[model samples]
Target chain A: MPRPNLAPPDAAPLREALRGIRFLLRRGGATVADTLTLDALPDPAAGLAKRMIREVEGLARSVDEAASAAAKGVLGGHDNPAEKLDEIVGHSSAAAEFGRAIYTALDAVLRRIGVDDAFISEMSARAVFAAWRQDHPHGQPQDWAADLTLRLLAARVIRGAVPAGSGSIGRVEPVAVFAVLLWLQSDRSESENEAVLEAAADIALARATEIAATIGSGDQGRIAALYRKYVDHV
Target chain B: MSKVRLTPDGLPPTNEPLRVAVRRLRWFKAAFLKHAEEMGAELGSRFEVDDTKLAAAFTRWLDAIELQRPADKSQRRAFFEFAAALMMRELTVDMPLKAVGEPSRAQTGSAAAFWPEGYCCTLFCLSVHAAATAQEFHADTTIDPAIDDLRHWWSFKENTIRDASFSAGFLQMLLGSQPNWVMPDVFRAKPRG
Candidate 1:
């Protein structure tokens, strides 16, 4: 018999592992938390864990600030004390004009992605945004461009379970999903096809759980078992 | 499904370290300025400023970081992104628009509605992706590596917009029986009972 290609789930980067530990500690000292604590391990890779922690902390701060600033910038709000003064003195038009400039830049980006077509819709955009918000409850969940594009495309593609029509930019190839996730990850360098597929699988798992819960499972025992396994592994 | 609203009131009290850090930072800033003015006032007023106060401010800022989560990289990225976005705002606030004409009110409103959350979220997502991906390829990426240089060229953003905070209870409600965390799953060695 052929042996299964069972490799250990690649250990997340040391910093990522440390981040996972810190987050668990912050949440609650559950079984999972106890299972993942960094201090208990006698592993030689201690530095890896420490770096992971630092990396996560650093990323958290950046994401929070960037998300907030980007949100505010495009929202037409005053930038700072100086800008506020400009607004108070009837420079509101100036602020509005500045917003327009940013909008134009954003529009250019959108056009480059070829989402300037009729395949997108506000409802689809809202759905994607809602899904993201649901997942990332604590951190910022706003990505207007991606959200808008995904929804528009998802609606066009997901007309049936088989994904009937072509997506916004035309045919929805598996690689397109990879590209989308890469863009979502803000990575443009190497197209790691495998990683993107993993991400899609993760999404599918989450969506499956939601649908099962809502549809009223006839096999409650099986549902409970599945949820336990998911919560245990994922 | 409908949106779940999270208000600040719903959140638990602020972490003690965070509160201490904020208070200490505020105190350090005030003391530094007073000391500077006192020393400077004697000479050119600015020349006699207290170096001690300046040192204290630096210490306080570091202390704030030390007191924050031991491993919250996203927090740091968010701060930088926030700063970068703010800089970008300053750069473009007085720029000219080349669109055919002014945007419609609805379009403008829609854009405004999307900017704040979208910018912050996107920046956070991007930075995390970059950092995490880089770490995966190399075993030894710096915890606080030369991300700033990348941000400078990549156009990082810092938020200047005011956003409403969700209540702490939001998570509690969502988790009901179990809390959801933005973390990867990892196994910890079990403690002896």
Candidate 2:
């Protein structure tokens, strides 16, 4: 039987929620956590904050549900969801753009919720590693591309820099992230190439984060050059 | 009756070196030929068996198997039989299906001849070879002789043996084998009682 197209439906709700959260973050004069605590306040702003918080949480849940459904479709072989996803997002499979989209959306929500970028990056890296360890208890760092891509994504998140092609940090399929994580966790031996790649990812992420911070996120040429420096070295 | 005492796992009661057991299993050639004929008959125009290449592939496969410690004493006989049946099916059935594109309904229907065990064994072997070859490619390590031979045979048949779903399934199976394996060593030899 011809497989059904399993592309996720329109994400208007998610987009709307992200916009609402971003607006609240900029204008509310309160951190995301502060907004959540508005019930304790007797001021008029408390009522508005309460309503906005509910809307933002509802939208975030909707995005999570959509991402989970897309992930299931990819795993179930309903279709080449990755290809459909790539078409929707317009990026290469290796770029892991689908995962970027999900991450980007979640990051937006988290940022508005008073979560710092460092914590987000650390958690994301740990989560990827945990998933990798679960799938491949003995797997070694075998695939260089997967390892490099993961480190790149992690670093981008740490710096709060947008992904190259996408205007946002971008979300990705968890399975794709998991696949890369498995490769990263595989072969923990400090072989020369493995050592070099590991170092390269670390050095690259740090340097990229620094460059993004100093020059601002809009310096695409410098950002590209910074990434290329590591890519070339590795 | 044969002097080789049979065990519960359908293997000889006493352990023998793989070479000795393989030498003793004189039926290997005959069994292989028999299965080859059956599979060829089933595949009809889509099948072609290259005896020289098939023998080479079998020897390479056997070499890899022999390196591993057997799980059961009776495993030698069972493994030899299993390998022969697997090679025969690959040479005739699966290879042809891959080569001629997806099988026709008539061809799919004919697969009733394959028992579930036989199908699993064939898939397991193919998955092992595929995984080994892919690892070799990534690591730039010398390819296994069996995988190299299989790749040559695949090329000869104009078949692309690397299917994504097949590789993913193989990875899942490989994960199941865990730290105990360097390759997808699914079939273990039975230990002697």
TM-score for all predictions? Answer: 0.16, 0.21
What is residue B78's positional error in candidate 2, in angstroms? Answer: 9.9
Give per-residue CA lDDT, model 2, range B46-117, as digits (tens). Answer: 333333334333443444454553677656543443343334333333332222322232223222222222
Kindly report which residue stretches of model 1 are placed more than 4 angstroms away from their true locations once superposed. A1-142, A153-155, A163-183, A186-188, A211-234, B1-193
lDDT of each: 0.29, 0.34
Worst 10 residues of 2 chain B by lDDT: B1-10
A81-191 per-residue lDDT for model 1 (tens digits):
212112222442332232332223222223333433211122333344446344542311123323323433444422211222342323322223322322233211133
Angstrom error of the Cα, residue A115, model 2: value is 77
The residue-level lDDT of candidate 2 at A151 comes to: 49
True contacts kept of 1: 0.00
The CA lDDT at A161 in model 1 is 18
